[model samples]
Target: MNIKKTVEKIPGGMMLAPLFLGAVLHTFWPGTGKYFGSFTNGMITGVVPILAVWLFCMGASIKISATGTVLKKSGTLVATKIATAWVCAFVFAQLLPEGGMVKTGFFAGLSVLAIVAAMD
Candidate 1:
């Protein structure tokens, strides 16, 4: 199967694929998480350069002309989405009893991204 095509066609599948694979890998390997944690310092160091490049690329892509109008609309949409996500997360966290780790993290990250993306 063409994974890229599958990911593009199915909504949320792209995100789910990595998550499912990680779960499966954890289940099968068991010790992979421990090994992964052991190598975290190296991973953190390596990620700095990659993150810097990403930020530079993103900064380069920003358009000066459409800043005002685009930012206004995008900010409103982002705020709405963040509010909805927060409500859903709170509800799920209360109902689950297990404490919705994924949902909570997702909503938290989404809120942060929205604020950053909407910033002037």
Candidate 2:
């Protein structure tokens, strides 16, 4: 099997297909979690498989990109995006209502994690 051909096809197959299927599933099975013990657990379980697949794909992509320049450029872009997102989240958290349920520090940490994960 040609890996390059398979990778090229992934934009339509792995990417769009999952997005379309997710939309369809969400539309048809909306509120299906209410029947489960806890909505949070049900939601997590439903999404875990997708998340696993995404992580595997990400690992594969990184493995295939052995070029130092490509890695450096990708790292810079990811860092910039993550820094921007973190600043935005921090600013938004600070501006939130006094009684807001979100903790500013927690959100900042989450933003950092998002950036770290993207780099990985």
Best by TM-score: 2
True-vs-predicted CA distance for residue 30, candidate 1, Å = 2.5
- Per-model TM-score, in order, reads 0.33, 0.37
User: Tens digit of lDDT per residue, candidate 1, span 12-100?
Assistant: 76556645665676578767656767454332334465456556776677899877887899899989987777766555556543433
> What are the runs in model 2 whose C-alpha is more than 4 Å off?
1-11, 33-56, 64-69, 78-120
lDDT (0-100) at residue 27 of candidate 1? Answer: 70
Residue 15 error, candidate 1, Å: 1.5
Q: What's the TM for model 2? A: 0.37
